[model samples]
Target chain A: MTQRQALSQSTGGTARGPALALDAGLLCILLVATPMTGSLTLLGETLRSALLFLRELSDWMTKKKLLAGSLAHYEFGVEKLAQAWTLAIALAMIIAGLWIAGLALDLIVTGESQTTSGGLALAAVTLALVTLRSGLQMLPFAQPKPRAFRFASLLVMQSMITLAALADDPSIALLADSFGAAFVALLMTAAGARLFSTAAVDLVDHPLNRKSEAYIAELLLEAGVEEEELLDLRTRRSGRDIFVELTINPSRAGSFEEARQRMGQLRRALAEQRDDLDVAIRLRAPGADSG
Target chain B: MPGPTRDQKSKEAAVLYTSLADLAVVTILFFFAVFTSSLTLLSEAIRVALMLLVEFYGLFVLRALHRDRLRRFRFGIGKVEQMCNLAIGAALLFSGFWVAHSVVAALLSVQAASTPLGLAAAAVISAVNLLINLLGWLAMAAAARDGDSAIYRAQLRARAVKLAASAIVQIAITIAALAKDPVVATLFDGIGAAFVAGVMVTIGFKMVAECLPDLLDHPLPGETKKEIEAALLSAGIAGEELLRLRTRCSGSLPQVELTLAPAGCASVTDYCRRVTAVENHLKDHLGGADVSVVVDARKPAET
Candidate 1:
């Protein structure tokens, strides 16, 4: 495998992290902005109550009698729904986390102590949900669940607090924000349940993406190495990275180091296409038994 | 480039001609209604104008797209819809704010004034507007399906939104005219305009966001990255860097640039042979990729 291809695999296990982080950031902003909206506080709760709704939706879609069982990412009768639910749940979790954190910083932690219990709980739930989803995404690679679904609990509790707030309740803006997060999350979950009722895995042809193919062509065209010396070529793509195998003739040389030098040049050229690629170069005799 | 299919070309011409005809109808009606200061006639004329504007927008967009087919989102032209969404969304949002403002004010100062001729005008306007909008909807769908342009897509969406807006306004006008409440009728128009604005703004925001990643240069699909690396490895070469790769496109073809170490060939002829092999390998994997290779030995190597 080429070094760029190897790097892709190594990094592939972590690509979802950024996506999770982005979602978390978006949620946090929404949750924090809740208290500022005053009468629009219910809008914020849209997020807090979202997690349970998503979980319920996921369960309904998967029909997984129990949420505690070990289910592979691929297996399911309603896999598409499950996948959609998972994505929604994960997205909600991230959003909730951001909301709670923002709420905590903006109102919960600094605000009155007694009124914040609900907000704190919902934030915790959101965190937990986010952690669970992130963990699942990378489980095949091995790592701790990124965070706890603290936002969910926080969202639910905050929502109740918001209800209280709405009816001449205390100044639990923090709680209101958490509740907003939950509410939005729940609504999204419900909507997603209807829209997505199965796991989703995208299988696509990759090498056709143009960048990889062109890069390879450039290397060979520029290398100035004889096409006759080049015996065979094979390429396969999985995800964004392409793995290449080729065989070429070894010309008369004073030393094997010269051939090695030529190989190094080729490697350097390939790297130009993508530094994060895995490349495997195999030297073989002409017309030898090759797979 | 594949020439436009016969049906597609014919449909394109029909859509354009029909839109123009619709515009002419709107103009004639508008003049006829305004000559007598008929509010009902005026409302119908406005609907016709909007429909004409939408069609023209679709036509121009289609023309531009056909002229420049290379413009696309990654490998496809998905970004056109995305951009249109942003612009329309913004327009809708702005329109919504304006309509809301007018409605709030009108509600505060409920005024009733309608030309005595308004009763006769209302019926004519309602009939004309309804007919025009329905025709516009059909024309929009045809243009949208036939032309792969953001304008056509936006026109389609705009028509759908207009349908709802027009329906609401129609209901409001019908009730107000029955009650002889001129203020309510005016209020309905303002609200309809506002609704259009708000919808456009929402669509605009969505488009802007969808297209942001491409502008930011996110990596290509992972499978593509691996394919290129594997091709290099299979060759009798090793230690090559799949250096900074940029995937761009011209029309439908992908353009790839791979910077690599200079060929370490004993002779220039031998060097050309090796490069040709890699090029062939790339072409085999990715059809019609324009590859550019730069030879620079000293670079940060990835292990």
Candidate 2:
């Protein structure tokens, strides 16, 4: 295993544990509050929280399995599986979002808003919990910046809707609750759409960024590989694993031994620069077909 | 990367046409489901919507594959297809749960019966849906008849399940609309929705089970492995020179990676030719496969 992979395996659970616990706690609170208050907004929150909980649970389980070395046999590691999980989460979010939106629209159309007596209290509690959750997620160890930003935006939106629901008129309060649920649904759908696109690209083996590609080429050149000798170079990323495959015509070296030594140097140099990288160097024979 | 073959193009076109047809049917069903407010129709609508999502996803992946857009992937598009299947199965399971939940809620609540007009509309729409699903099933079956990939086979199976569910929906709606007894109507409605849920769960479970092992990079079947070994032996690759051989499936594509200790080859050119020959031989034997052969130039005693 590469050093980065080892580090990730050791610290993966620690990084995700607190966030998962927070999500579970918030999910439980919303689950209990949704039925008690009959609040559509709370129901939406509960569903969103449940999906988030599932996502975290899957990540945790995958990391645990990685740590146990059970997934080592996978040639490309479990990066594709992680990408698949992301796709699943995106689909679930979109489905949940549409369902919630449908329910809210039905209520609006029928003009049969139920009296949610404790909705304000439930909203306040949830807003507080989500605020805390967002704060925790912002910590470096918790999640990626984009995800943290998503949660933070959700906090702002949740706060706005909660304030709106504090109206004196019951009818206005109900409208606020319905609109709040609709807003939550929109947020979820947008996030899901973004995640879906990213996962789709990754699953198709999108190439590494140009800067990284340039750096790898520079490293190979620095390791005494000639520019013309480098026949082909391909780089791609899956989850946290980066793969670099190089096809080289090592005719510059006088013998196979010298060529082998050059390949080792290239591998060691690349490994030192990026621990997550898996490098494959293919020595092409003169007059051989590229295939 | 090579361009997609004639058979591949035909398969892609078939998938695209089916998905477009599904989109049209689902769009119409959505409106009818909203108007009728029949639980059975609503469940069917939701189920079809989910299926459409997966169908479109599969179509996108298929197009990408045919266009050679994913050539940078060393293992080909097998994992991507598997991921698509996993998403489809997961979506099916989710829809099944939602349908089951709605069914339970309806059974517990004292609900008003649908208007006569609504019931009539639902029955008509369901009958149309049944016919569409039947046509889709046949189309997919024809497409998969030539022995296609995992995605195509899965689509065929999904189409079959959709056909069965559509039949159930049509019958349930017709019975509920004609039956004089309210109890019988409600019972049939619940049963129909429950059956749809059951169908979804069963197919979803099967897809997930079949795709998970492949996604996990489990080895190819023992028989296939033996064949691969025999093929390698016949190709003049001695057991000692073959340092490592790993075989796995990506969707329906077999992937084989071989590491060889380039022992007695007169030159690098000779070794490359030998490896190329071995790859071609294996590809021919395996029908088609992604075969990668790497030469380990280090001596066995280097360690």
Top-TM-score candidate index? 2
Give the per-residue lDDT digits (tens) of candidate 1, residues B1-303.
Answer: 555665556446755766766677788788887687664456546545644654665566566556565342223333333333433443444345445555565456764534535634554665565566677777656545543455555655656665666666666556555555666556554555466556645654564455433322234455776776676677654645454455543223344556444346555335545565666667667775645442333323542
Query: How well does candidate 2 score on lDDT at residue A69?
Result: 79
DockQ (model 2, Cα)? 0.30
Candidates' TM-scores? Answer: 0.39, 0.82
* Per-candidate DockQ vs. reference: 0.02, 0.30
Q: After superposition, how far is residue A219 of candidate 2 from its true place, in Å?
A: 4.4
Best by DockQ: 2
Model 2 pairs in collision: none
Model 2 backbone overlap count:
0
Name the runs in model 1 displaced over 4 angstroms: A1-291, B1-4, B25-58, B64-127, B140-151, B180-194, B211-240, B247-256, B261-303
- Residues A1-291 of candidate 1: C-alpha lDDT, one tens digit per residue: 753355345434446347545655645644664343332233434454345444643444233322323332211112323333454465445434544444444454455433343544444344445445544545565344323333344445445543545444455554555445444445444444433222111111112336755566557768755677666554534223345545556553333345556766777676766664445444444543221
How far residue B41's Cα lies from its native spot in candidate 1, in Å, is: 11
Output the lDDT of residue A290, model 1: 20
